[model samples]
Target chain A: MLRDITLGQYYQADSVIHKLDPRVKLGTTIIFIISLFVFQGAWGYAVAALFLALVIKLSKVPFQFMVKGMKAIVFLLLITVIFNLFLTPGEPLVTVWKLTITKEGLRMAVFLSIRLGFLIIGSSVMTLTTTPNQLTDGLEKMLKPLNKIKVPVHEIAMMMSIALRFIPILMEETDKIMKAQLARCADFESGNLIKKAKSLVPLLVPLFISAFRRANDLAMAMEARCYRGGDNRTKMKPLHYEKRDYIAYAIVACYVILGIAAGKLMPLLVSGIIQLV
Target chain B: MPIILDKVSHVYGQDTAMAVTALKNVSLVIPDGQFIGLIGHTGSGKSTLVQHLNGLMKATSGSIYFNGEDIDAEGFDKKMLRSKVGLVFQYPEHQLFETDVFADVCFGPKNLGLSKKEVELRAYEALKLVGLEDAYFYQSPFDLSGGQKRRVAIAGVLAMKPEVLVLDEPTAGLDPKGRDEILDQISRLKKETGMTVILVSHSMDDVAKYVERIIVMNKGSVMYDDAPREVFRHYQELEQIGLAAPQVTYIMKDLQDHGYDVSDEATTIEKAKEEIKSWFARLSAVGKGR
Candidate 1:
């Protein structure tokens, strides 16, 4: 039952986005996340939404599959929306006891929620389209400049990719262990908070031990193959910018420009709405 | 029925892009107090079939019944069923997490809400049944040898006192000595306790030697369900699915072809020995009678 988790899961499909250079996709994902903060108006959000939609369409990833990733962040999204919706001070539209629903608060809350949604969905698009190995190569290349500052950029990228690759492996292992424990009459559910926490000890101990064992075996295997950090290591398939990547970059650049223009015009539009009200 | 799978089929990731049919229209009845060996190549759905016996997984298009009761029926406690049909997974030692061997063994009985005394008693008895020494019980299970750790894991399942013990590749990754010891213990446990034991293994010799019945699987369906000799008679068919009867069975069959008067159905080392001895005895007896 624990296998329902889909976080960091890559959907395998061939499409235009999947064909783009990993470095370009990585840069665009960062750009997209940053644009979520830069643009503050409906016009800006509209541009962002269109950009994300077009990417999803080009990636050939099922819309339902991308939305499935959103389910993981539902609780966090609710907390953010609730905190902003009720706590933000603004012109009171309705008052009920200690609670006040304000026009400005409502506006800010909607905008914030929309912003958070786009941020998550946009990055999910990147991950869904790009494989973990590709993402790692992209990250390492982009972070090459950081190496001059004595940062172990290659090591960091290697670690990140290895961790990402192990997520599903560990998850499957967890599912197996859970079944093994269940066969032993281990009651994980239907316990008090303290008891439930205690129940995890049985599950966690073996999981941790196996994880360490696997890590040790992996290290040994790597060493056996003469792996010694990322120094002078060459990739079989290097990431390169192609015609599709340039087209994608151009489209994303246009979206960012439109978002900036919308941010600049937001105040005028809000004022016009206020006059109408 | 001790366990009955009725037209049971399981499709992993059904309707998804990665959809795979692991078990297909597999209907079988497992009688009580019988030792059964399930043999299959990798990805042949033997694992999926055993999981269904305990309701660990729901069949995609059919039903599973334990003791004639529908497992998927509303209010049926699947957890209880799981405890009743204890499954020791492959590399089960990897599931041992308790600090000490004794504590790990007790983990299963404790979950059944047994009294402290009963839990300890069951754990002790289970450990004893697995042929583990009392000296190793209080020590860290991880500190033990691979075989010892395996004993603790098996004890953990046995403590549940399951009626049907489903061991999936229990002897895997063990040294030959450890493998024989574990198999011997399982055989003894089956005889003494009269528990229905389902042994899933790739070792044809072990299955032929121990289990009275063999269920051969290929491509998610049962190909042969018969006595070891009957099943081994179709060694060519088994070989088609990347499986084979014991090497001794092949040897005997070849010897019989070479004009030796011997049965070619021997599927174990001991059985082949007996067959050759019997053939020699028959030759002497015929000469003396003349």
Candidate 2:
């Protein structure tokens, strides 16, 4: 039952977006997030949406699959929407007993909700197209200059890749332990909050113990293979800036520039047209 | 009453690209108190089949009946079914989490809402049934040896007083002595409690010696379901599917081929020894007559 989670999971598909360098995808995702904050007007949102739609279409990861990741953030999204709707002070649209729904509040809630939703979809698109190992490699390459500042970038990257690799393994272990507990008639469902939390003790203890044991085994296995940090490590598949990666960067940069220009210049152009008319 | 599976099929990740048919139109009836061995190579669907016994997994098509009632029927008590069919997973020692052995064994019965007195009593009995001593009862389960920890885990299930015990490769990581000890205890438990025992293992010799019947699985289907001797008769076919009959079966066949006139049906070492002795007795009798 725990297998349905889609967050940060790579969707296997052969498409132009998936074939692009991971560095390009990572940079695009970061720029997209920044652009979401920069783009304030309707025209700006339209441009951002258009660019996002194009990238998602090219990625070939199904639209439904990308939206599945949004389910995890539904609670956070609701809290943000509620806070914006009730707390913002402006000309009231609707009054309900002690609460007033202001026009500005409604607008802020809608705008912020869209921003959060788009932000999640944008980042998930990158993860869906790129594998964890590739993402780590991209991060390491992008942060290579940090090594001069005494940052252990390579070690940090190695740890991240390993952590990502262990996600599914640990998930499977948890599934097994859960079933084992189930076989003993352990009721994980149909309980109050306290009872439910109490029930998890049996499941979690074994899981934590097994996880530590597995980690120990992994460390020993790595040591046995003479893995002495990434000091002199050579890549089996080194990262390179291909033609497609450069093209992707160009497209993303143009989208960000267009979004910023739309937000900055759209109002002036609208008033200028009104004066001329 | 017997547990019956009628044309049961299970497809993992159904309607997806990665879908796999783990069990295909499988049919079987496990009687009330039979020591049945489920033998299959890896990915042969043995584990999937056993999970269906306790309603741990639902079949994609068809149905399973426990004591003549459909287990998947509306309002059927699944928790009761689980307690009735205790599943001891592979590396069961990993399931032990309670601070002490006795407390760990009590986990199952406690879930059943049993009284404190009865829970402790059942735990005590279960520990004794698995041949774990009283001295170790209060000791930490994590501090015990691998075999002892496994026994405590088994007792955890046993305390529920399940009518059928389904153990999946219980001796997988244990040494030879530990393996035999655990298997012997299971065999003894079956005889003493009259509980239906379904031992899922790929090992031919272990099943041949302990189980009264053997079911061979291949590629998500039952390849053979018969007495140990009858099943072992098709050792060549079993080997073709990445499984083999017990070593003694091959030895008995070899003896017959070498003109010893021994019965090739012997599937276990003890049976093979008796057959070879009888063959010698017959040979000396014929020599005296000549």
Best by DockQ: 2
Residues A29-49 of candidate 1: C-alpha lDDT, one tens digit per residue: 899999998987778888888
Question: Individual DockQ of the candidates?
Answer: 0.72, 0.82
| lDDT for predicted candidate 1 compared with the true structure | 0.88
User: Model 1: runs farther than 4 Å from truth?
Assistant: A95-98, A262-277, B284-290
Clashing residue pairs in candidate 2 (N, C-alpha, C atoms within 3 angstroms): none
Candidate 1, after superposition: displacement of residue B6 in Å?
1.8
Q: What clash pairs does model 1 have?
A: none
